[model samples]
Target: MKETVFLTGAGSGIGKAIAKKLSADGYDLVLIGRRLNKLQETATEINRPSECLELDLSLGSQIVTDTVKSWIQDHSENQVIGLVNNAGQFLRSPFGDDQDDWDLLFQVNLMGPVNLTRALWPHFQKNREGRIVNISSNLGQTPVAGTSAYSALKAALDNFTKCLALEGGAFNIRVNSVAPGLVDTPIHDFHQKDDSGSLQLKAALHGMHPLSRMGQAEDIAGAVSYFLNPNNSWTTGAILNVDGGLSLTSKDP
Candidate 1:
């Protein structure tokens, strides 16, 4: 029987890359995201057995837990061995901007993962083995000017990863996070009002990375795969930085 993995935000960007990599590496996938069409697109591209679940992480904890339970019931043949908590909201706001944005960020980034993990805890305990990888941000460890809420949520997620690792250790479950730097994806398109601004912003991001280029989605995906691999069974609670050396430098370029 093939091992199955549940992945949130599997519609695009790093999540999509992770889906492709894991599929190619011979694991079936359960793709979860808000857009069914986009998730289906990713599933089709992977060309493997996958279930596309349209879910919004901002809906709160109970909803996510119920949805996950339903998913498990619906897909009984596939034994879920791993979970990738990659869904996140990026809000670029200074303090005192929109309080709603901050709440939404926390809901999606921190609470969603927490709820999902709580729901899956019993399942992992029953199985006696599991893997969890969270897609965090470089700003989680290094603070920046404009991304206060995003950074805080990711930092919380990083800490949550450690806590889950400790709790799940005796059950033979491992939890880790991959903190990625700037990657060229639609997530940044929100700030790109026009082609010129987009290009300039992209260039600036590239310059900020000590490696001299923005990271690719696959770069983060590779790190996620490393943690998910059963060969790395002894490792847990690790925050792997797949940031193109961006963490080493300040934001100024």
Candidate 2:
């Protein structure tokens, strides 16, 4: 039987890309997202058997845990062997923004992964093998203006990845993160309202990287596949920067 991977935020962007890559590589997928229709759409594209679940990760810890448990129970035959915490909310706001915004950001970007990982940890422990790949951002390591909340949360996530790796080492559960630079995805649509603005913004972002180009979702997905592969089994507690050399540039204006 093929191993299964539970991926959060599988409806779009990096999450969707990861789903397609993993499916092609012969893993059954349990795709989770807030939009049922979008999740179903993604499921249809994959050749491997997949299940879609509608979940709002930011809702609460109990709800997230309960929902995941239910899925595990239902898919007992597949035997989940991997998890990708790819779901995240990117809210660009100044430091003095409303407190509610801060709370929501943490809940979605941080707590959601924490809750789901905690819920699935026992299964990994029982199986004596598992892989967890977190979708982090370069912003987590390099501070950028107007993304205080997102940067902070991702920073915390990176640290959390290391901590989990240390704890799960004896159990053979590998935990790692992939931090990508600016990628061409709908996530940037909020800033680029028009074609002209998008073109300018794309140029500026591309200029920030030494590669002279922004990243594609497939670029990040490739790195994720590397970590997920059992052949690359010795690596853990590592943060792989799939940023097209963006981290090498100065963060100054």
Candidate 3:
């Protein structure tokens, strides 16, 4: 049977890099994202057997369960053993009365992962083997102002990763997380680089890291790959920070 991994947000950024790395390492893929075309692009770049699913992680509950059910039915030839909870949206807090922002953050960032994991738990337990890697953020621990919700949700995810790890041991399932610092992904492309101000901000961000450079998606992908590798099977409940040493300092600008 093909060893397949279901990866959320596999369409781009860190998720895309992770997908590529896993494909190179000999794993089939089930790419999940909101955009079908984007997921197909990732599939087109890989040589191994792969499937793409258009899913919005924020729409938790029965939708998630149903999606998993049909997914299992459709890909019966593949043994799904890994899940990357990388689908998430970023948000800054202190929105005052904007309750929607907080709600959206909770649903997409925390609840979505929870719901999906719960939906997949039965399959993993039945197999008695699986791996889960969550893509979290450094802000979850080293939080700064105006990012309370995002940090808190990620912190919850980190804890959830740990809790699942503890419970999964009985079934030979290992759970871990990769908490990344600033990376040069589309999430950080809010400003036009043509402007001097934006250019200066980007430079400052690069300098903030002790490594004297901004992190690439591949940098974070390497850590996720480490956690997923069967050779490192003993490791579980670990939250590895792939932050280019940014977590070592109190810098964020």
Candidate 4:
């Protein structure tokens, strides 16, 4: 029986790539994102048994959780077996003492995934074989300047992923995270917005990676493919960095 996986942030970047990859592997999908048009585009491109929900994590909307709850309630008897908590936000804010930016980043980057997973826990507990994949970032491992809030949230997420894996392992539910470096995505374009030094900084970051190239969406998606496979029964509580050698550059001789 083909399994169903609910994937968030499926409108762009790594999420889009993962959706296409999983669809090609014959998985049913529930694609969640903030943009209706982009989500529809992903759905059309995949052409699988899929559904979409337009949701914004920054809105403090409970709609996403409610949708997931309803989905589990409706599909508990079906093969709904995996989740990809890939929705997140990134910003270039300084490490100011202001609570607003800090709280906002935590809410979107950390709390959103946590909340959704908590909501979906019952389904996994009942099924005894579901898996979760949280998309983190290389910044979580090595805190960089100018992205304090974003990096901190991802770091917290990595920790929480381990906790989830440990708690869910006995139930046969696997939990893991994927941390990617600077991928060639719109997020980086937004990160580089209007900065005169952006080009130099981008080049430097690219050069720092041992691969000497920015990561592609497919690169991250490949990791998702591996982590979610039924063949991967023995792996859990792992943080796989699919970052084109960016995270490993410090280990290089």
Greater lDDT among 2 and 4 belongs to 2
Clashes of 2: 0
Residues 1-253 of candidate 1: C-alpha lDDT, one tens digit per residue: 5699999999989899999999988899999999999999999999789989898988988898899899888778889999999988788766889588788887888888988888888999999989999999999999798778888889999999999899999999999999999988789877678656767877888989889999999998889889999999999999988898989887843
Worst 10 residues of 4 by lDDT: 244-253
- In order, how many clashes per candidate? 0, 0, 0, 0
Model 1 poorest ten-residue lDDT run: 190-199
Model 4 whole-model lDDT (C-alpha atoms): 0.84
Report lDDT (CA) for all predictions: 0.89, 0.90, 0.88, 0.84
Candidate 4 clashing pairs? none
Tens digits of per-residue lDDT for model 4, 28-139: 9989888989999999999688888877776654765787778766765557788898988777656676467687888788888887787778878987877999999998
What TM-score would each prediction reach against the true structure? 0.97, 0.96, 0.96, 0.91
What stretches of model 1 exceed 4 Å from their correct place? none
Candidate 2 runs further than 4 Å off? 194-196
Error of 2 at 55 (Å): 0.1
lDDT for residue 247 in candidate 3, whole number 0-100 = 93
